[model samples]
Target: MLPAPSRPPRLRALAVAAAGLVVLTSLTGCTQIASAFNGLQQNAVSTPAPRPAVTQAVSMPYDSKFTYDGSVSLSTDVADGLEVRLDVWAADPKRTQEWAPDNDKTFGFAVNVVDHRVDEKAVLTQKRRVYMSMISITSQVSQSTIGQQQMMSPFQFSADPRTLVPSDTMRSDRGLLLNTFQGGLLVPTTTIHQLPADTYGITLQFALQVWVEGTANTDTSFQQQTVYQVLPIAIFSPTTPTQ
Candidate 1:
């Protein structure tokens, strides 16, 4: 014969146990699926892209040709019997960087009494002649421990800094040494005149000096080359009487 029928209370207890199991599964879903992530992953949400490279501006110790159209009027007898005057013009970015004593000191294109040719006896056949300049290049790089706050390109190359003396530096002897140099340079006004006019096929070769301490680190050098030629002009004869 069969056993007695199950009680209602016994059925109710079985239903409650089944409901508890379902609740436990819902609360701990990760625990059951832990094995699915055995191979782990580690990555940042976002990444920065690499920047493109840039090229720096090349300067002295590497010779380059520049064209000029400057305006000036020279007085024949000035600067201890030399023709001296002023010029207002533009120079090549490369060349201006080469001549400045301190590149940051200025970016102005001005004039000076930079040339002198003696007429001793044989004077030019014309007066008021438009002149061409055969400039010799001098450059040096100064490197002082830049204060952490320093900013901008600190190199200033200029051929005529002595003339730019603010009233303060006018009487200074060491002013040129302190003010007119990268590390140090001695660009006498005569350097421009001494350049060879041997006519390397109608080109005037000027001297270029190697500067150190700025950016061209090693014992750098600038080779001799014809940088520029002047535009020809006819002027009143230098030998003409002062009418």
Candidate 2:
């Protein structure tokens, strides 16, 4: 009831202005809050999602045990029943089972020429003959980083095949007769020194120079030719302790 006393006009006006300022401040604060919330929402919508990580595949080393005691048979369309058989194996079977690049390795190979058209019991001169004059082997190693690496042979073997034969047999300038009274050629073993550290596989290429008779009845019509054979051996990496 005491407030019924009339207030001053200027004071009334000042009170009205203060009330309007409070309302304007409240509206401005609310608008700022709303604008901040909308900015956050827009940022969330515009941002890109993270990408996934990439991984590469790894390859395993080759195993030597797979090729031991393997034989390769070769023949040409020019001759029927004339086959050249090659048998290859590790000199030390136990050691080669775990072949490594640092250690020395030896391999053995045998070459046999067979003429199925003639009797097995026939004498050397009477059968279709294949004379082996030269035997050579070249090697290559497969490496992951270097691709293919060429290697030098530890030993060189070049001889007349007939020289290895018995003195009782008749010798000919043509070379050693593979299909003879005896069996085929046998190379006990050829040693290979240490290879590149990263070698995973080894390839041995065998080249044989030979004189093959055109007819089974006579050796006079012999023609010279070269025969090639490839043999692959896997190599293992040196073992290391796991971390």
- Give lDDT: candidate 2, residue 74: 37
lDDT of each: 0.22, 0.53
Q: How many clashes in each candidate? A: 17, 0
Score candidate 2 by lDDT. Answer: 0.53
**Runs with alpha carbons beyond 4 Å of true place in candidate 2:** 1-78, 147-157, 162-170, 239-243
lDDT of 1 by residue, 1-243 (tens): 112222235223322432232222342332322211111101111122332343232221222222121222222332233332222222222222222222211111212222233332222221111222222323222212222122221111223333322232222222221111111111211211111111011112223121111111122321222222222111111221221
Q: In candidate 2, residue 104 scores what lDDT? A: 69
Candidate 1 residue 225 Cα shift, in angstroms, is: 16
| Alpha-carbon runs more than 4 Å astray in model 1 | 1-80, 86-106, 112-130, 146-243
lDDT of 2 at 42: 30
Alpha-carbon shift of residue 89 in model 2 (angstroms): 1.4
